[model samples]
Target chain A: MRFQLTEDQTALRRATRDLLERRFGERERRAAAGGGSLDRALWRTLGDAGFFALCLPERDGGVGLGFPEAVLVFEEAGRALLTGPLIATLRAAGEVPGAASGETVVAAADGWTVEWLAAADVARPDTADAVAVRSVDPLTPLHRVARAARVDPVAVLLTAAEQLGTAVRVCELAVQHARTREQFGRPIGAFQAVQHLCAGLLVRAETARAAVYAAAVTGARTDIAAARLLADEAAVDGARDCLQVHGGMGFTWESEVHLHLKRAWVRAGRGGGGAAAEEALAAALTA
Target chain B: MDLSHTPEDEEFRARLRAWLATALPVLPPPPDPADWPARRARDLGWQRALYDAGYGELHWDASPTTRLIFLEETEAAGAPYVGANFVGLLHAGPTIAAEGTDGQRRRWLPPILRGEEVWCQGFSEPGAGSDLASLRTRARRDGDHYVVDGSKIWTSHAEVADWCELLVRTDPDAPRHRGISWLAMPMDAPGVTVRPLRTLAGSAEFAEVFLDGVRIPVANRVGAENDGWRVTMVTLSFERGTAFVGEVVACRRVLRELAAAARRDGRWDDAVLRRRLGRLNAEFLALWRLTQWNVSEAAAGGGVPGVGGSVFKLRYSHARQDLYDAAADVLGPGALDLDSPWVLDRLSSLSYTIAAGTSQIQRTIVAERMLGLPRGR
Candidate 1:
């Protein structure tokens, strides 16, 4: 009946958080984004630490953990806004062989289009004639892979995990801004308007975190669809709200808040858009 | 985490379901306030039936998992609400069980369990709605009794209640939150009067209660004097109980009904409406999972609720309202008809946002308490 992460899971969370904070803080994150390519060193560091093998099998020379642990690691990755083919690479670990060792970076494909094709050592087997496309999110490199019949739901689930993390991160950012930034000699958080925005974001983030985490554990397509839907909304709208809280500073390129918004906007269209998740939910409910 | 129930819990649920196959009450709450006697009788009869069948004490010492099973099964069986004894069962009974003296528990809890004595809460006043600590309801001591004076508004079921859990200022000179006391007062006491107030939806199930020098024995006090605020807090926390499990079940029912209605009315094909319905359904799923996770967390040794009560209440209220709004979108004018089942629900949903604490206050609680946002100047 208990719903919390276990002591081991909590320890995993703290370690992941500490790693991201020390290795991928604001300056490093922006620099990596500006470089517009994968941080090979950081990626290798994570793989060496078993970040990519949390859900893999011990028999396969990887940690024998579960989806709960996998999502915990992804939650940190999302918070750090870690770039490149992490999701695709993790998914490919059990499929493409070399991916498990961080020696091969597999660019994730969503139907015909893929992300970070230029940065990957390997691409999904189905992708062909990949062509680079200008990306809206500075942190992600987009490519148009040849049209394919399928988009993996696991890919969507991973994107949903990132969205959940970003949602929580933006909520923290909003609260931090609201408490420290003042208007008319009071913290902006003292205003009901700002309070409600922060509160709403907190609810959305917490709610989506629950959904996404449960979906990971349950491995139910319907639950995953709902999680993706909610995480998308939370992250996208939460970033907008956080930007509002930061006022003019948030609009500046120097502020990391806009990066959150850009990433959310880009992620909202990835794996599967709102319409796809909506169809899955509608089918489940109507059927 | 596992969401499935233990075998024993499943068996407990199955037994209740089997009993409810025939024992569950079917009387829809009457629209007419005048029909309250029949309604009250039916509600009590249903409660007594469950009591005799071993549900009255089901929650007294039950695990969170077991209590959730009870609520889920009861909601599934369409069992009637404890009706006029809602306050007694949900708030007062638990408060008595937790804070009452042994004699008070024995004296007060059984009737409540058996549905023999209905209860109402005397907490809100015209001047003290959100700022409840500022209530002017005075309870002055006068030789072994407290002479109570002042009024309370929005006291639901006051007209039908046999007793009330009253909060009053026992010391005007003391700090606002420190001077209060909680008491169990017989509703028929001298100088006690109840005037029914019709809600905007036109249900007279709530009332305004006045006590003009109503003399209640000091023995009625539940906790020590000047500690009433803590008692009141204990009572408020009980509002976030297993009832949320039932609500999730009920919500699924209504959502299915609304979807079916949308299909029959040919509105299901409306892309905008379909998208909205889909989003709302997803939102409901998230909320349900959140609650289930909360229950599972509590069962796994999480502490009793804190600001979470406000958070869930606030979120669930909005979800319910959003559902009804989507219903209206599905049914259009059909939802506006007063005779439509959903019309009453849609009209009544607004009160949820206002009652207990307004949505505004709820947001404040979540911001200041849960998120640690700065308090307003």
Candidate 2:
């Protein structure tokens, strides 16, 4: 069995990365983050690009690709740090009337909180009495809602794919900073301490990548739970380590390192703060 | 990104499983771990069976996927491991196939594949463990032979091995890494001594060998005189990469057993305990996927593993340790009983981080080779 990406799959990933980087690259992302809301025009552009309809069947006027391909696209979105109801909108593609075409926005309730609820046309569980709350990640605004529902394994796997992407991106950032940033008459990467930190980040990221990719293929509940757990650990811990490699500069609002850590923190809390995945895995093991 | 096996792979798997169904039961009971002769015989008998079935050379001859299938099936069927034959089957045999001369391969490959001989490793010396390039096992050239003089520690199954894949310092003035040569030293040579080294688990599977003027033929050199380090790295990649495929399956089995015990003992009620077992389960499952990734990558890029092997090795070492730690939590007070299940496994888990390559060295490999980080000194 070949566990690596095929030529077409690799090309799809590269193409999706190129598309997202053009729209949500650092400059565009920062410019859009200042508003703290979803850009409808850009959202429609994503819909036109078939981002949301990636997994809808061809009979429904969509891309008809499977979860694996959608997972790849979402990974690129995560790497670009694209915010909004992306996961919710993507999950609602077949169910929500206009979601597949980007004419409608969908937001899924994550426990008692919903992200970008004010801009959403439909909420997954129809939360009422929503109140906007300050979020740690400036780009992702949250609205507290009176709805809590069990998340399906597919959503968990998709969220894990996003975390995998963040893990990989932060690992690259840490390695880059360690190489260029100097301390004690040399680059900090020359020190074993910094080097090991970056190495550990890479190890965690790669391990999570494998798990996420395998889970996408298998789609097993246990596999998805494991993937979620590993991807969360990798993304959260990797961003923290990436920040460590950047030293004082990473602490500034101007640098993108803290943004990644904040985003990772927010995402880790999305699928029940890792407790749900942990409990699911524990149940599987105990059975 | 297909993870499904090919039709041929599935067919081969089916045949191997059928063969093992009949083969494993008729075999005699396994000898004690400390029984060197008996263990050798049992292991060789299994190898001979594989040889007769045309699967003996799968390690080097077949595709990586096929080899993986063989390993998975054998482990699942409770077939014998390459216990006394690991150094030969996994390390030296593959290295020789990759770097040895045609003549050398014809001579050494047949006996090992046929289960007619066993090989032990002679790479780690007393003075050089992690810094293996500084090894001072002197092999002074004299006519057509090299007179080897030194001591090698942690030689596994040396008491039963017929050959030793040796590394020695052939040049004193060259660079530390450039002065070494690889030799195949006969274990029965004069002035060669083997003293079993007792492990913390109280097993003598490893030994220390003292060589005083043990002579080895020049024809036995696998590569150029000073190119042994590269060849040894090839052997080590095999050691770190595919050598542990069987153990992963075994670990999964042990994890299931641990989970069952947790349920039986009412420890499953503890969310913390259940969560620990669950996390270990995830860890092994991820490790298994990582193994598949590495093997698939190796299949694509020749038969040698890349830096990804180090990543897998670094994590798998700790995962095995964690699995046993959870096992102890499941066992409660019985963890200390020597005869209890997994007690020996728990004890042996301590060496996983130290053997093959230390976790420290693995981190260096990943940092420098994989991440492109600057090397420290």
How far residue A287's Cα lies from its native spot in candidate 2, in Å, is 4.4
Fnat values, candidates in order: 0.66, 0.71
What's the TM-score of every candidate structure? 0.96, 0.98
| lDDT for predicted candidate 1 compared with the true structure | 0.83
- Candidate 2 structure quality by residue, lDDT tens digits, B196-283: 9999999897999999999899999999998999999988988878888888999988988888888888888888988887887788
Number of the predicted model whose TM-score against the real structure is largest: 2
Q: Which regions of candidate 2 are displaced past 4 Å?
A: none
Against the unseen true structure, what C-alpha lDDT does each candidate score? Answer: 0.83, 0.88
B1-377, model 1: which lDDT tens digit per residue?
Answer: 55667788888888888888867445445445467777677777777877888888655557777877888788877876566868888888888888999999999999888868888999999999989999999999999999999999999888878999999999999989999999999999999999999888887868999899999999999999989999988778667645567877788878878778888878887878877777777888888788877777667754354566666777788999998888877777777688776877888888888888898888888899988987884
Top candidate (DockQ): 2
